[model samples]
Target: MEGEEGTQNAHLILARKLFLLTHPDVQDIEKVRLREEVFDAVKSDDMAPLYETLAADKIIEMDQSILDSMRAKIGDEIRKLDEKIADAEENLGESEVREAHLAKSLFYIRIGDKDKALEQLKVTESKTVAVGQKMDLVFYTLQIGFFYMDFDLISKSIDKAKNLFEEGGDWERKNRLKVYEGLYCMSTRNFDKAASLFLDSISTFTTYDLFPYDTFVFYTVLTSIISLDRVSLKQKVVDAPEILTVIGKIPCLSEFLNSLYDCQYKSFFSAFAGLTEQIKFDRYLHPHFRYYMREVRTVVYSQFLESYKSVTIDAMAKAFGVTIEFIDLELSRFISAGKLHCKIDKVAGVLETNRPDAKNALYQSTIKQGDFLLNRIQKLSRVIDL
Candidate 1:
């Protein structure tokens, strides 16, 4: 009898806390009175009335543990709420019905019925809701996107979020969407676009004092290194004040960036090798690892071509810390792609670089200039005739 009384007192305390926690602002006299009634119902252990009060109040942020307790004590009542959700439209207005669906979804999620939860979410998505409620729905949709690796849905969710927050005067949400969009681009191996987005996000985060500045800067520098030319990197990222501040804070990233900038292939590769597993396993970075590595190799090989007139394949392999066969294959790719004006001597095991013919280069430049002049003249002629 003592234990039973103790349990009842605990329940009463929890019920009161829940009511207090969720009660609307004091200025709202109607909500305050309703919440008092709900508190009374909770005190009387009349959970049916308590649930109705909570749903009418649109209180969906209750702790999962509390909901779990409610489920155990009055599960049939909650299940009945789910069944009645479809019919809610006949009795309640659309907004109230959507609130009921949202509440039902939360309940399903807490009870480990994700499919039902997703089903409820889908229904809620089709209905119109306020901006705040829409934001909540999009957030939950993004979570589902990540869980299932639904890239298409994730992309759509990102677009929806951007549209929702673009003019909503929410700088933080806008910048966050930019970061997620950048991550999606990075995952798709669209390094150029990703680099641009990351730079913009870094600027916003820095200006607004957003958290995760370190992560934003990391990806910005990394994507810039992979996609941007040295001149662009210097102008857009390396010399940017916000990015420089971030680099100053993250020492390893600083070292890596410097190594890449200075064309120190050995140091750059070593720095990358020492990167944390967090970077390696990052959802965005993991998929692009091979592509980024290849870009790094291209950067290294481009530098090598400019530095040496001829280098032995063995020496190149040793410098790059790779096998001769690997070096040969990479060189073959570069040569075939016309990115490197070089030829490999198989017998001599030498990579001979070819400088562009000055006469041919000058001739090509003259032709390009002449074509531009002709196009201008034709445009001027047309203007004169007109």
Candidate 2:
């Protein structure tokens, strides 16, 4: 009888502890009074401990009506308790206990523990054989590929995701699967493959069947593909002005493209810096690149002769609006093309200019005459059919 009474006292103490978590600690008496009202419900036997815990969480605090509605359900209270347990685990160190189990490897990723995340995903993949969870399993599989930067695994994961989607899986899951495929191709340095995937993903996301939530992912993936260096992939970087004109069609991607332009400007300035001693005009520009190099050349030459007398990469990036690395890429290209001539003098620091007229004069003479003839022919063609 004495033991039973002790157990009952312990239960009452546990109930009181749970109730205290919901009581607001603010100095405002009215706020405190309002919290007490909720706390009283928590202490009552009418609701379970899960209800009391949910009441303490910020998700519910933002909207009490959700909690009130959820409280009416029986087993859902257990689900709510599970959610609180998940939230509590988030506050622990990067190595979470729950992350090492089941179909929830994403929790480990959220904390940046990629190794542990992969381990959890492998475990989940082994245990789940059900058809309905294939998409979920595929999602975690792609996450594993990204976390470890495993290009081969990324390629295989795309195939797995496609198979899952084709099997009549969830619409939302399929949309995400398409995105993962495109991202995987990009990660593997398969830019051409990724470009097609991104375009297809965009089409799928725009279709009325897809949820609005998927739009952000679609735009981000498209931007990533377009932003890749055309030189790196041996493809032409499309004219920025032309690309910007079409950018508005994707509302989610407009701001991101503006940022890409800012990055391109920074890149152009970096290239200018390396060519200060010898302006190489043709090294980095791809065969199909359409931007006029004359404007960039003019700006760089003026800066080279400016009052600041600081023609270093850092200063050039500031003056021309681009990152230092971008300037470096352009410089290397010019050097390779033999368009820039470099020399050093103490007073001039590093001085650069286009190749001397004597050496390049013959080549320029042919190109200019040929270009002038071609322009005349094109003009005449526009005026007359033949």
- Point to the candidate with the largest TM-score: 1
Least accurate 10 contiguous residues by lDDT in model 2: 279-288
Listed in order, each prediction's TM-score against the native is: 0.59, 0.32
lDDT of 1 at 306: 81
Model 1 lDDT, residue 295, Cα: 76
Candidate 2: segments with Cα more than 4 A from true spot: 1-123, 126-132, 203-386
For model 1 the TM-score comes to 0.59
Model 1 — which ten-residue stretch has the worst lDDT? Answer: 1-10
- Model 1 C-alpha lDDT versus the unseen true structure: 0.67
Give one digit per residue, the lDDT tens place, for model 2 in 104-216: 45544433344655676676566555545656656655555553456677778778777756666776566656656655554444445655655555544432221232333
Provide the RMSD of all predictions against the true structure, rounded to 1 decimal.
16.0, 21.1
Kindly report the root-mean-square deviation of model 1 from the true structure over all alpha carbons: 16.0
What are the per-residue Cα lDDT tens digits for candidate 1 across 131-244?
A: 666766775665555434568987998888878875463565566567667767876788889898888776665321112567668778888887887888888886799988
